[model samples]
Target: MRAAVFDRFGPPEVLHVVHVPDPRPGPGEVRVRVLAAGVQPFDVAVRAGEMPWAKIQFPQTLGQEYAGLIDAVGEGVDDFVPGDPVLGSTMLNGAAELLCVAAENVVRKPAALDFPTAAALVAASQTASGSLLELGVGEGDVLLMHAAAGSVGTVATQLARRAGATVIGTASLRNHDRLRRQGAIPVTYGQDLIQDVRDLGLQPTAALDAAGGEAIAQSVELGIPLDRIGTIVDDKAAADHGTRVVRAGRDPKRLAAVIDLAARGEVVIPVQPFPLDEIVEAHRTVESRHSDGKVVLLIAS
Candidate 1:
């Protein structure tokens, strides 16, 4: 099997495909023939040796989310059979031709969602859903979402809207229309962000910061209670501002619910795709942090 791996952390150029022994599922696990994998900021950080706690071995594969079809199931795994199309989060080997993951973690993919889209939704769906849940966002609340055009923000905005909250999202003028279509009142992010939201005449009852930097500070200035301001990015800023750091941990159930919404077209995740061999370019795109949607590696079928 071939997988994208890096021997030494540096940049996207360090990542390359290499042949490795194929993995077989252990008990309670299933081996999936990966069709697509989502490239994330985390992957780029790991590649750059910026994540202090991440254990990086030479030839380490760096991906967290993937969509694929089951080819084999190990003992004690009965719910999924061969040919089951599924998507889920994996620890580090998602950007590979084949990967083994716990059967319990995989969500059955609906036919309506393609592999790339399903892969794209795995992390963002869970993160967005959990952030909203942790912040207790609901009807009658106006939510301020930073980086609303990005992957996690995109999902968060839609989910918040579904929960009856009015969302004001921060993005460039180019993405304002896209944010509007996703049910968010779009505002530009920067020094005047707080005033911009004020100009809209909607006070943010809560805020979700998917973009780091000054997001936490801006949310604080919006008069939202510190407890109501949650950030998935910028832990330092959250701590400094007394805002909550919502570590939206991976939950298959939460991921599945959002996936269902996506399947039904109630939510959508736009995907930018590159073939698996172009893994370097995929990582580069994610690192650029300018992609309009999730970046996915389209592995060969």
Candidate 2:
């Protein structure tokens, strides 16, 4: 199998394409012939050695979300067989032609989406869905999403709105119209964030920080209760202030909700797709944060 492998963590240049041994499924696992792998800030963090909560082993193949065909099933796996289309995340080894994931983690691919789009959905949508579930968003609730134009932000905004909650989202002035089109009240990041929500006559009952910047910290300072704020970023200060950290597997129900929402077209996978050989370029694009969509690596092609 050909994979993007790196023995050391550093810049994107550290990532290299090389021929590696094909992975075999473990008990209750399935080996997927990957068509695409989703690139995210988490992947960048693994590359840059910025993640302190979790450590990646050396000679790592970095990727979290993937879409592909199940080429083989391990012992005790009965829900799927070879040639089944699936999309999901793995503990590691996602940036490769073959990956082994727990059979329970894989979901059947939605008929309406292709491999690349399905690959893009797992990370951003699952994160957003799980966080919103932790916050308990509902009808008449005012949900504030930081960084509304980005991939996770866009999906979060739409899911919250679809739940009958009023959504207020923040982005740069350039992305305001895009956020508005997704049914969120757009507020440009700055001091005006609070004012913009005020203008809408909506008091934020819950807030989630997908942006993970100083603005998120400042916004949390204003009136929302600490327990009502959740952050996906590495902001320990969010916890210090009594907010929740949206950690691994906080709610399995939320993961199921994201999958169902994707199947129903109420959620979207906003991505900029690049071929696997262009892994370096994809890394740079995601590192720059200039693109408004999730950067995905196409593996099969």
For each candidate, how many residue pairs have backbone atoms clashing (under 3 Å)?
0, 0
RMSD of 2: 2.0
On residues 14-48, what C-alpha lDDT tens digit does candidate 1 reach at each position? 98999999999999999999999999999999999
lDDT of 2 at 64: 86
TM-scores across all candidates?
A: 0.99, 0.92
- The alpha-carbon RMSD values of the candidates against the true structure, listed in the order shown, are 0.7, 2.0
lDDT of 1 at 178: 94
lDDT, model 2? 0.82
Residue pairs with colliding backbones in model 2 are none
Q: Using lDDT as the measure, which candidate wins?
A: 1
Candidate 1 Cα RMSD after full superposition onto the native fold (Å): 0.7
Residue 136, candidate 1: alpha-carbon lDDT: 97
lDDT per residue for candidate 2 within 43-80, as digits (tens), equals 88888888766667778888988899999999999999
